[model samples]
Target: MQQYAILTYHQIDLAPPPPAQFRSLYVAPSAFARQMACLKALGYRGVSMRELLPYLRGDRVGKVVGLTFDDGYCNNLERALPVLQKCGFTATCYVMSHLLGKTNVWDIENGVTQAALMSAAQIRQWAQAGMEIGAHTQTHCKLPLMADADAMREISDCKAELGALLGEPVEHFCYPYGLYEARHAAMAQAAGYQSATTTQRGKVVVGTDFFQLRRIPVVRSTFMPQFLLKLLTGYENGKGA
Candidate 1:
């Protein structure tokens, strides 16, 4: 089988000092640059979900890695974009339709450090710069906990809302907090999404489920060797549910 590693990232800026929750989610800008450079050096093209679709569908094959940023952060634009452009790569940033220009308020209950999400203009710039913008929902809510009707609306309406913003079809979707159920997968498919990625730890292959496609996360603590292992080998496969 042809396997591809879809690497997940969040913030791409300096990590806040200790005691700030979810520090693992931040990847220092310098480190991110190095990682992208390493991929380029290794002859791998870091691509967006849109570009990786053919490979995932067995239509084409090459050394490509799906680069994705979850919960669209302003730093992703400020810090990650230049590095990606320098590397001649494209990535996907999944933004919450209703939360643009706002902080991650849904994480307040968990005491997670609030970070500014990309504003509407910044999102447009991201798209203008050849990056893909995927939908993360209207609000960053856990789909499995919501009523079915509400969950469906979150799934479908986000695609519509973001499509309107980008003036093109938003073909990708991602579950909030990586918390979803089988029904949510069905909902994503019904929402007209080409694919939906999850927090599941594994590499995707040609036969992998499109809606529940697995991903490998890159975090603050992921050093280069480990990152390469996750990206180039089966180190992360079968590790998460």
Candidate 2:
């Protein structure tokens, strides 16, 4: 069986998080680097979602894993890139299109840290460094409550905007808050995205949904033992999600 773990991440730094949110959203840079090193040591090559498509399609599969970052925080390029480059891997960052060069106001309103997102130039630079840029909507809004046209614009328009910014086709997406319904997938498909990722936790196997793909979350609290469990069994604490 062809299997892969699509690992998802957010801000990756050792800086203390703001007083409001769970620490799980902040995976330490050392831990992030260690995770990548572990994957490589185990003979797994971390790949971008775009690069993992063929393996997902039942072609030949090696020990491959997919790495992704959500919200496109500046630290992704500033901190995660070097670790990834050291690991001989490439990954994708899902950018909130309209929020480039701005702080994460959405998370702030929800009492999370007011972290800075990547500027347009930083995004371009990351892409130039061989990382893939995926769309994460214009405002990082959830899709299920949105009307058809609104959802289409969030999904489709964001893709177009990022493609223009990166000077390449943006063909992957991620639903905000990992919340979605079937209609959202249709919107993503109509937007010309080859695939979309979700927060649903599991190891990806053959026949996984291209649109509603599950991801293994690497977070601050995922220490070595728990991380090993997730990699070995596709679940954390055996919850499977």
Candidate 3:
């Protein structure tokens, strides 16, 4: 069986700024670099969603890994990109369309605080640097709770805008906050995406659902030992979960 892992990261700052909403979610930039170095040292191959299609269908290969960054934070471009470039790994970034030049407003556990999102120009630069950009929806709204028509509009419109901005089709999506239901998957399909990702923790197996691909969340405390376990074993069986 072909096994694939999708790792998720939020901010890559050394320390979360005072009043930073997701202080707990911040991973130091150097820590991210170390994680990438470990992966490279272990001979893991980074595969994008497009490249993973065959593996998803049961095509076997050496250890395969997928890296995904969510929320379109500017640090993704500032911190994560350089580390990824160093390791020669490519990742998919999910951007919230309405928050393009603004900040995320729905910081539930962290209160109603905000954090900077990437600007259109920054997103374009990342695209030019070979990072895949995907839609996280127009407002980062929870899709499962949205009305069908509203959900469709959020998914489709974001893709259209991103496609226009990048001059290419935005073919993948990540659920906001890893929240979604069957209706959400249907809406993503209606939006013309080839695949969609989720916060569900597990290694993607040969027969895993493409529309609701699982991802392993990487946080500040996940050092080399934890990181290697999560990569080799699924998150459900690893320490993070």
RMSD (CA, angstroms), candidate 2: 1.6
| Candidate 1 error regions (>4 Å) | none
Worst ten-residue run, lDDT, model 2? 232-241
- The most accurate candidate by lDDT is 1
For all candidates in order, the CA lDDT equals 0.94, 0.87, 0.82
- Model 3 lDDT on a 0 to 1 scale: 0.82
| Per-model TM-score on C-alpha atoms | 0.99, 0.95, 0.91
Please say which candidate is ahead in TM-score: 1 or 2: 1
Give residue 102's error in model 2 in angstroms. Answer: 0.7
Q: Write the per-residue lDDT of candidate 2 for residues 55-148, one digit (tens) a residue.
A: 8988767788899999999999999999988888999999988999998888766677678899999999889888899999999997888888
Off by over 4 Å in 2: 15-18, 236-241
Question: In order, what is each prediction's RMSD in angstroms?
Answer: 0.7, 1.6, 2.3
**Ranking of all predicted structures according to lDDT, beginning with the best and ending with the worst:** 1, 2, 3
Per-residue alpha-carbon lDDT of model 3 for 98-198, expressed as tens digits? Answer: 88978867775666346688999999988888888889999988787888889889999999989998899999998887888898888888878988998
TM-score of 3: 0.91
